[model samples]
Target chain A: MNKELVEKIKNDPNYQELVSKRSSFSIKLTIAMLAVYFAFILTIAFKPALLGTPLSADSVTTVGIPVGIAVIIFAFILTGIYTKRANTEFDDLTNKIKNAIKEH
Target chain B: MNRTFLFLVLGSIAVFASGAIEGEVQKQALNMSAIVMFLIFVSATLGITYWAAKRTKSAKDFYTAGGGITGFQNGMAIAGDYMSAASFLGISGLVYMKGYDGLIYSIGFLVGWPIILFMIAEPLRNLGKYTFADVASYRLRQTPIRTLAASGSIATVVLYLIAQMVGAGKLIELLFGLNYEVAVILVGVLMILYVTFGGMLATTWVQIIKAFLLLSGASFMAIAVMAHYDFSFGALFTHATELKGIAIMSPGGLVSDPISAISLAIALMFGTAGLPHILMRFFTVSDAKEARKSVFYATGFIGYFYILTFIIGFGAIVMVFKNPAYLDVVKNAVDGTSPILGGSNMAAIHLSHAVGGDFFLGFISAVAFATILAVVSGLTLAGASAISHDLYASVIKRGNVDSMKEMRVSKIATVILGIVAIIMGIMFEKQNIAFVVGLAFAIAASANFPILVLSMYWRKLTTRGAVVGGSLGLATAILLVILSPTVWVKILGYKTAIFPYEHPALFSVAVAFIAIWFFSITDKSENAKEEQEAFEAQYIRSQTGIGAEGASH
Candidate 1:
């Protein structure tokens, strides 16, 4: 690509907005995921019996089953949130940036 | 022409059938249903390959199906690539054997997808063409960076191939009652045909179909298991706890220590983003929007699939573990404990028969075989792209090679990779290969992931830093694996491991980041300055998709 176009896009406020919003959003989501996963892993490492405890006194199922499945579901949910925002909000900013460059 | 291809496929199947019959007479009764189902799957895939071959006229078409795949389709294909035979059988088998411990792996694997979607997927789609090396080498020195990326890709691919191949051979032996060598050869041959002729389009279709079949089959098994318990997981777990004890509901010996747990978690998480086959799936979409969408769908499908496998595992524990019919009585008598017919890895396979009978067993067996073919084909294509697109086209020829020549080179590489996979599969048949996949993940997380991430994110990453840091990370990961317990104690017959932990990603990734930071800041070269300056354009393209290859309609 030409230098002028890149410079123009780089300096565009929409591009800046898109980059900052997306990066922060992604970083937050990433931190959330790592936190959840590492929490689960650490729990497994240090306190195995905690997860082994049944839901109720008479219950056969342990707490780990739902917890593990929750982590998986949380991951999917996080992806959904990101995709929804990226396709709608961030993508709008990107299109504005592109249009600005084209008109120039 | 179609008739000729059909004849060729049938002729090969005939030869394999004869060999299987001769080999199985000494083992046990032949599984005619499995063989028939497998033949049908193989014939259908071969027909898809024949069709894809017609449309694959350009290098772009060969690599990314001309970027024509929709978001949802690419999502299914990505899920197909991720849900290999290893994850399906291996994780379920772990659950069957160790109970709640298996969920650790499932969670680790699923967690990578969200991270990939959040960070890597869009930038990757906005930047690269064909292989991931395109992104890594975007502003850096092409030759060294491409060389490094290709080495990492090939190493990851070959290691993963060996694991998949060995597992395929053994699983087919138990499931199809076929000879191990025949099974390996069958996988290698089918992979070669799919990739060499059909390219990305065929590979994607094959993966999607296999993913669909596997999901449906596993769903059926899970539903069947739940049906027996009135659709209550509590009832199922109650039975499992009664049979296997309550210890099965908690963590076992898989990750006993804190460091090992964290190290393994890191490897499983980032190693996925570094995987070439998975990363390559991004470019198959038309734009970054589709790329993002694909990950969303892939994560959901994969997470749902893992949940099914967990159910299947617990189901197997309750159904197949105590059943005398599925147990090998002689072995059980000697061991004083009932063991399933083909070991714990066959837990899901045995559960298929217990729950769904011979016909369903035949279907699951075929699906498992198809899963292997799909995974290996994806691996082979990635490896070939590394060799041809990165090494031959860009590095060796200085990006001057014609598309046709590059395509031919990739085809040749695919054939070579297939042969090597088959041979290695046979060679490693008796050896313990459980560590191979882990090592692949380690290398990917350490080497490929660091450089790719740094090149895109770190403004000061020079060619020197990337080459030095990536090579050190790669070397360290491999070296640590060699000195770790899995290899040193188990394979090499050493009494004690030099590396205390089995996983090396934590240390190796730290080394890579530190080394890259150290080298890039210390460098005083004019070229380094220019590379730093070039990052703005690369970043713009990465963020905004301006000047991105194949983005223009």
Candidate 2:
């Protein structure tokens, strides 16, 4: 580990500017939270209850298949978004920090 | 689309897929060969436990798997351990019941990873060792700080373990047709063996194995589900909407409201980094780098797993609504108000039957049972570690420690906790234990997270601050949970209850943060340097045990 590398990251203006960008996450988190909370409320307000039955027992089976397909499609989108960001943003910063620290 | 056609599809598939020619699950599930194979799996788990107990050699191995697991293995284990009965059955179960409400928890849980990746993982890997308490107590002394963090960690693990155990018992009875008490005892004994014998090593292996199996099982279901839509993304969304209404395909309802959604996400996102057991996995790895890599792997694995759960939940509703037989009973049970389903855990099982038949259902059930075993084993190891390592060696023996004696204490603690879990699981067999498990996360996020975060960043923190913050956080969370209305009626499902706080995580986490700041300011006399040095040593020990695979080794 290089001691001077630690000094550079601690003092470097460029690195400090990058560090300053972290506050954006806190803001993004707020947005994500709002999306979840408001969505939950709106769904209940509009639908109130499932348009179907509660106890689908005894009956052979008619429920899950199509519903699952829907969820799978939605999940693919969600995961695609997560994978994209994790690589582009998270991986980039984490690697930079490691590089700076390792040199130290 | 008619009743006759739906029944014909389901009934014919159910009969043809059984493979036994008998076409019955209840009958073939109890066969002699299957029983023997089940016993073999149980025995293999016990053998590892036996190995753990014999090779105990030192206190370090008992607590942290000698701190030698590679990042990849540790990552798998972390995902494995953290996934639990809740992640496996609970999330999918939620999706099964609530259409989109299930999506709320999935989004809440998976979205949390970005926070850790951006903020906490590396710092936590670099901070104090062993327990989250080690981080908190870095600035504070042992008496109050360590005790509070330990208490919080222990209480959370114990309650969560009870949920896992009781859930296993009931689930096994339903899936395997075994006696309820017998199933609980079976899992209890296997977990005790896993922890008491192989200690952390056995527990880690079991968790890793469980993670792989769970992932594979979920992937299989996801594939079958995608197949139903002919690999067309557009088709899936449209079909799902057709089955459960367009609302089910979308992500909103109660959570669309910002204030409540943000508050809930706060608990979840921060909660992941804060969780003791999850963070503890970082310590199990040999170095800080390994910890980082593990998180990356865990992020990918867990991300995919959550998506699979969402699909499984939707699948249950679609298969039933289309076939009619599945929805008929569920609709009647919940009075046409609930989804065409009765329980969330059933989502995966029902999906298997819909796609493959009773045989597939039985096999999926077996995997689920194995999942409970893997999770419970990890939880027990965690509990035993807190007791034998933190309390026994650190507190009871203080500076002068006997390695062999500490190992023995861990084994005994393992047995004791296992028994206690069995008793509690049975007591709460009928109650919805998921809420109780959530409380564990609440306390962990509050008491454990702050101490860990502060210790890593604030170089000037004093011992008193750690002590006050941890104690205040732990006490606030537990007290609120005990008094909360949900715990009053839902946990034990008791009829008489008062108090209305459905979420103690929201309040307890707040109090903990305030206490940390207040106490740190008040206690200005403690030596900050000494605390930092001591905390680092503990962290090193946690990541690399004293005699095992740590740097010293």
Best by DockQ: 1
Residue-level error in angstroms, candidate 1, position B228: 1.2
RMSD of 2: 8.8
By DockQ thresholds, what CAPRI class is model 1?
Answer: high
What's the DockQ of model 1?
0.87
DockQ metric for all predictions: 0.87, 0.08
> What is the model-wide C-alpha lDDT for candidate 2?
0.61
Q: Report the Cα lDDT for candidate 1.
A: 0.86
| Top TM-score hit | 1
| Candidate 2 structure quality by residue, lDDT tens digits, B412-476 | 98899999988887786665444555566677777777777777656556667766776777787
lDDT of 1 by residue, B51-122 (tens): 999999888989998898989999999999989887787778778877887787678788989989888998
